[model samples]
Target: MSARQPHELLLAARPVEILGVALSPVEYSGVRVMTLTMIDQVHKRPDGTARRNFNEHRARLVMGEDFFELNQPNEIRALGFSRPQGGTPAAVLLLTEAGYSMLVKSFTDDLAWDVQRLLVKSYFAKPAPATDPLASLPPEQRALIALMVDNASIKAEQAAQSQALAAQAEVQAEQGAAITAVGQRVGDLADTMLMLARPAGAESIVHIRERINKLHGLPSRIIDEVLRQSPIAPKPAGMVKHSREEARGGSYAVYWIKDVSAVFARFSGECTRITATQVTHPYIDGRFKLLPARDRP
Candidate 1:
């Protein structure tokens, strides 16, 4: 079949689950095509691994027939990706079944083989959704069907209302749990304040972050970046003991808190009003679920 445009596919695609991953479906022409991001996740490869494979083997692959490149923001956004928070992606590479087969030729693992089989048999070759049986009926027949649907909906609504009332106690319990979480967050703030009152001596990034978090209200990640990258920020005094299981070799570098404190206060203060915003991209994870045609921008 001739490939339809990306926008056309957006109307017909529906979400599907494979190996516990919820894939945001995208079809081109009549065949399902997956982005490099999706391919990386579905195959358990690191992020950008698929893209790296494609780039390394581009000389052997055919364009338009085997793969399609979407560089325009609107084109990519139509596939259910939100705009990048920082900047635009260079290009989003979408691969056909043929392309995927060619790209992963080196992935000889059992999991790779199983996933390829499933993608071919279940994902790419899956049948389209059946059309509504009543869609082609006469006006009079359609009216009769609509009336029946309305009556059934009324009964369902009544049943739903009863269920809602029964679920109210569970809702109250959830609210109480939320309140307890708020109290725990308050305790964390108190700990941060206590750390702040201590002498302005050397401390680990982990410890210094708490004070910065309490004073500047910036995320730990952002604070870490600012301190690490800023020229004015001081270097680590020496390595400190780390007891956390996540730490490698059970040790990490510790910086002087006095140096980092000034850097955090300066940068965090510059951004006085920080609006909470989220920019999501399509992944096997449902962080960016496939939006319906009506919901797509």
Candidate 2:
């Protein structure tokens, strides 16, 4: 397939397993700088465009020096896995056993939120009505995921309530405007994509339903299509959505995500838990001040 524009590229991201992945430190010019400012921009423009520069930094990153490591485990977590045999199926909300196994290894507070969002969307597949879906997590990590999910659920429910209040207010205000209420209609997924044939702004998977909720004339999907293709559509950072398909023993499920790193980094600033400093050494006596000093008083 041709390279997708960045906004649309999220659509192509699919859930795949991480194999042979390990986290190690970097050697910035023989200096070990341990701290990682996860969301630092290398070549991002003023308008948020990450310029496609294929030079030293981009080239090295593309070559995969350090993939996002969820939490700390020190020189472990095999990230250097062989290329997956088949094309990585678009990362779905539900990952394959191997993929999820690798994923949980790197789970962090950020990841727990992501899992909750997916589970909410797949409300039908929630493990239990009031129970936490992350129950399967290890005892050490379970509390963390559980706490994160509880907070997220509360927030999401609150947001939904706020949206409802806003809508009610809008309806009341528009009552005198005689805005005719529109009823439901139906269309398949492709028709929905056609609406975004010319996307206005970036749209992430999470806001689709909410966007669709505001329209009052035609079908919700139509409203979604229009908003998604409108100039104000959001450019979501992390998750992707694909055509509906059977996933996790359920149908009509099609959300996928690839860059948990971007998700966590964007929301919480600095997403990774494992990053070592590039060795920072002053002098080798024989070659005093080998590297130029970054600061001179």
Candidate 3:
């Protein structure tokens, strides 16, 4: 008698669990056999008034393979087949040894059971087939499916809008910080220029005014006022003095002015001073007066 085929023997055995569900594959002689099993379990609560319930269903599909290999046992198990070594071989080989090992590793280690369950549930319970043979679906179920689709679309739009808004807010905040920083720098520069322009004793007001104009971009009139508020010294003797008469036309006459009054005179006889003829009218309305030659003691 000829040896029994592996597929024939496999069909005779009961179904086994691979990942979580029990599965089996059967070959028929003439007619196609399709089997579906639904298993329901309930556990009573401590109060006996409530029960936790679960329903699991599986569908068996018949597929053909040419050969089988032994390296990966779990892959065959998941597909409702025994390990290659545990069964007799047919004339045709289905999968190579290396392929079987890779499949088994992917099934046992790489695939997540929770994600698989969610996918299965979504496929079987959520979507409706175009040609479902079932007689009728309840109104509530149709409404629920519609609501779920609408809610998913709304959530996606909301998430996108929220991300865009967050990005805009971040950009605005950065711009605001940069503007504040620039304002602070300008204030600091102005303060530094003011400090440098402050006049001390024996410093020429004109020289201080010129420095202030260069450093702070201030008008010459503002520089002069700043210098006038500060201390100054008398012009030294023997310094060449230019008269305003020589200051006519486009030329300016630079001269030294001597102070012979008050504290500056008590300490020193004379200090160097600078006077420049005005080419443009001073911004402040004031007359530039040359000090009367010091009265002879």
Among all candidates shown, the one with the greatest lDDT: 1
Q: Estimate each model's TM-score.
A: 0.39, 0.15, 0.24
Model 3's number of clashes is: 9
Query: For candidate 2, what is the TM-score?
Result: 0.15
Indicate the residue-level lDDT of 53 in model 1. Answer: 94
Encode model 1's per-residue lDDT on 25-142: one tens digit a residue: 7776556788888888888999879989999999888987788877778766655555347555667777898999999998899989988887888777767789988888999999
Report the Cα lDDT for residue 223, model 3.
42
The candidate with the higher TM-score, 1 or 2, is 1
The candidate, 1 or 3, that scores higher on TM-score is 1
C-alpha positional error of residue 202 in candidate 3 after TM-score superposition, expressed in Å: 13
Question: 1 or 3: which has the higher lDDT?
Answer: 1
Model 2 error, position 129 (Å) = 19
Candidate 2, residue 204: how far the Cα is off, in Å: 71
- Give the residue spans of candidate 3 off by over 4 A: 1-139, 197-297
The digit string of per-residue lDDT tens for model 2 on 86-181 reads 432221111222222232332345644454344224321323458766677799798887789899999999999999999999989887455433
Worst 10 residues of 3 by lDDT: 49-58
- C-alpha root-mean-square deviation, candidate 2: 45.4
